[model samples]
Target: METSLEEDSRTKEFDGVIFGASDQVFSRYEDSSTEVTYTYILQTAGEFGCFQRILVALTFIPNILSAFFMLGGTFMLKMQPHHCNTDWLLAIQPNLTMSQLFNLTLPRKKDGSFEECRMYTPVQWDFDSIVKYGLNDTQDCQNGWFYLSHEWSLITEFDLVCNKASERLRAYCIFVAGLFCGSLLVGTLCDRIGRYKSILLMLMFYAVFGLGAAFVPTFSIYQMFQFGIGIAIMGYTISSISLVIEWLVSSRRVHAIVLAQCFLVLGHLVLSVLSASIPHWRLLHLVGSIPVIFLVSYIWLLPESPLWLMMRGNVEKAKFLLCRAASINKRIIPPELLQKLTNEKIHQGTIMDILKSPNLRRRTLILSYVWLCIGLGYVGLSSQLHKFPINMNGSHLAFRLVEVPARLCSIISMEKLGRRKSQVLALLLGGLTCLYSAFIPEDLTSITTTLALMGQIGLSAAFTIACIFSAELFPTGLRQVGLSFVSLSYSIGVIGTLLIESLDHDHPETFMTVCGIMTTVGGLLCILLPKG
Candidate 1:
């Protein structure tokens, strides 16, 4: 009996050892599985992080290039001579036809001995002498002791005045119409289509219209081209701004847009040099078109906005694109995170939706007024570059240079201080300066000039702030629409140019009254806008 009991105990001990060994092996296997899973997760995360970085790089490079192209022409236009070139005269003249002679005719004497024969028959005739002596002599001789040709002078004066007035009217009309249509058209289109498509379309329009403007022969044709250019500008400006804001994380959006405007100033500076060098308006237009061609190459490079795609119910496509972006930026997006991103709700908005929402309606109204103010203060002021007391080209260059630092200051302040405070202060100060400009004594015109400079600085800052703040107010879905609407307000501001242009510089009050009212009204409206 004792031997049997001892055998049972030995068997139990062996069984216990086998059970312990099996359990130990299973625990080791489980740990190895967990280690493998962790390694895979780390690797995936690193890849996604890299993808995100790539997306940012891809988005930023094109935007920089686009900004360069859009502002290039305007800068060039501002820098070119306000007066017509005399170079054309050197090519054809002095081989006069009867018609040409009639075009250049002096009056006939009653005795037909060339009323003042000495003036008509030059002593030393070169091209320079002909220009200096011929036209002046002919007009003067015709005026005195001859047929009054009051009819001719009246016709010539009427024609010259009519042509100039038409040109000015056309420029302002195109600018205003383009601003309005661009905002409305681009805003609506971007909502229906995607951001990428809208951009591509706008770029095409820019390239085509820009080229057309460069080559058009008639003033009427040129006005049409300007209208086209305006449309293209409005479309691209609103969409590009909205896209940039949407793509960046909230913390960085305002700084990015402000910095982008700084690049715009840089573009203006570059254009100033190009305009000074090129001299021909057509060539300047051609230069603007060249940069836009690069945008086509980005067709494969740029991705559609994931948020936009998602809102449109393109979940799978959005996921794929987002994954690709994440891959490019090298962000490690995990399966669970990807799932969460896919499940997230997106607002698929319409224009009616924008109008219907009370919050948005109020926001839109304030933004429109702000837009008007910007158009008036910024565009109105900038457009008067030609009318400045200094050389037009020199003033343009100076203004471009000043804008650079002002934009830089705006960027720094926007980040450090926030959008509302910066804009309100800037606009109010700018308006007050404009008002005070009215009171500046003519003898102290130098002081007025100095104050004008100060006002410019403030106005530039205010403009920059307005763009930054407007961009921040809307959600991604309505961002483009919001910007477009705001852009329309800018068009309304262009009317101020007509008002400015009508003012006689000698009566500084005319300029002061209009500008002061605009700046002050703009500043006041800005106060009501929501703090972004």
Candidate 2:
């Protein structure tokens, strides 16, 4: 009799018919009783007030760190100008200038560029013997390689130039694989353990492995750390974003998400400055990841999601958090609203929940494909930007700057046109821009550069919209799982981009064309998704 009474109370609390705020339905309750729902209570607490703003601000730290760890690789693993390390010749001729040394020991191609991987065989004789012998022989770098700049990079530190060049691609693949695996593991953890705990756990992983990446001595060990960073970053991203969105009401969710994405852009901007100022990759990575130590203080500062608490049937805790939010927002939650907050224990969603339902399965497939294209297009264009005539800093700054307007546009479009159309518009615009740029002649560097920036703008908007849309499509219980599944496709896309680059390093046009086609297809499929 006692257990049956508790079940009856749980059903009454959750089965209440609630309506939107616009309808002025706050006072309505099930059986004409005063048992309000979490949604209504969250609205009553205030949607876009002081509490939400503070949470949004806290998210910037992780987003910026995400940029550092994710895009930092652009500079950290870059291919610097290098040649065979032939400094041994200096032993015979101490006065040899760098130009003299290169002219004597290195072979030149038909276009007069020195061979980067091979140098003439060295001899013990004085420099005159080498000059007299006319140095016709060449072999793989006998000593190793020398970079124009001694600054640390994967290329310089790992000797990834000649035979080892392929290792860079392999390292990237390993990192992406980590991201894929982390999405599954962390997404499940977030749903099972609650968002706050998941964030804390992922932060620990991110900081430890990120620092480990900076200090590891060998390329093999470095790859191991990179893989760990990959997993940690994906988990951090999914958990943090989910936490933020869960706290916000539907009306403010898009705006808050857009605001958080701006921090991600700022992260890239900060990364550009740091990359320029910090010459050593290890030090740069160290600086980027070290902030997590400070961020750990969030354990005391951040609050658990009240809705999650309610879903887990910790009604008293949820009520306390709601009251706190209301107090901070300077609103009074009537005692009656808190008196009947008895929610049942909702089942935590799993990957099977997404697959068992046909509606969810369709949405997951479509959103996953969209996410995949967004990842490929965004990373592909950003990676290829250096191929243009602009300087490196300028390209990076310009690319990140575009996101400011792009995300702003996303907010407006999502609010005005709704999710499906907004996503389709952003994707198509990005796709067409990329495709058009691909056909442009290589001589038109300015045109190509401008078009690339425009394409990124569209992609940036699409990325922001996709994040919100995917979250909204799933219920709170399944939100993290659904997002993780979609994000797995993103990892696949990144890996695909890397493979394309490895296959055709010389022709970025082919890669861009492929990205454009895939993005367009993803956008067109959005039409089939159920309308908002």
Clashes of each: 20, 0
**TM-score (all chains, Cα) for each model:** 0.72, 0.91
Cα lDDT of model 2 by residue, 1-532, tens digit: 3457655553333223234432211112211322236667777888767877788788757888888888888889888999998988888888988999999999998999999988998777767777887787788898888789867777787788888888888888888988988887888787679889988887887778877788888999988888888898898888888888767766777788898889888889999999889999889999888887888788988888876786678888888888888888888888897776776755456777667566667878999999999989898888886787877877899899989999998887876777889999999999989999989998998888888888999999999989887876765556777889999999988888888887565775788799889999999999987564
Worst 10 residues of 2 by lDDT: 22-31
Q: What TM-score should be assigned to candidate 1?
A: 0.72
The lDDT of each candidate is: 0.59, 0.81
Instruction: Judge candidate 2 at residue 158 and give its lDDT.
Output: 79
Candidate 1 off by > 4 Å = 1-162, 343-345, 442-445, 504-508
239-340: candidate 1 lDDT, tens digit per residue:
666665445544455566666677677666666676567654556667755776776776776667655665666767766865565556656466674554
Best by TM-score: 2
Model 1 worst lDDT window (10 residues):
17-26
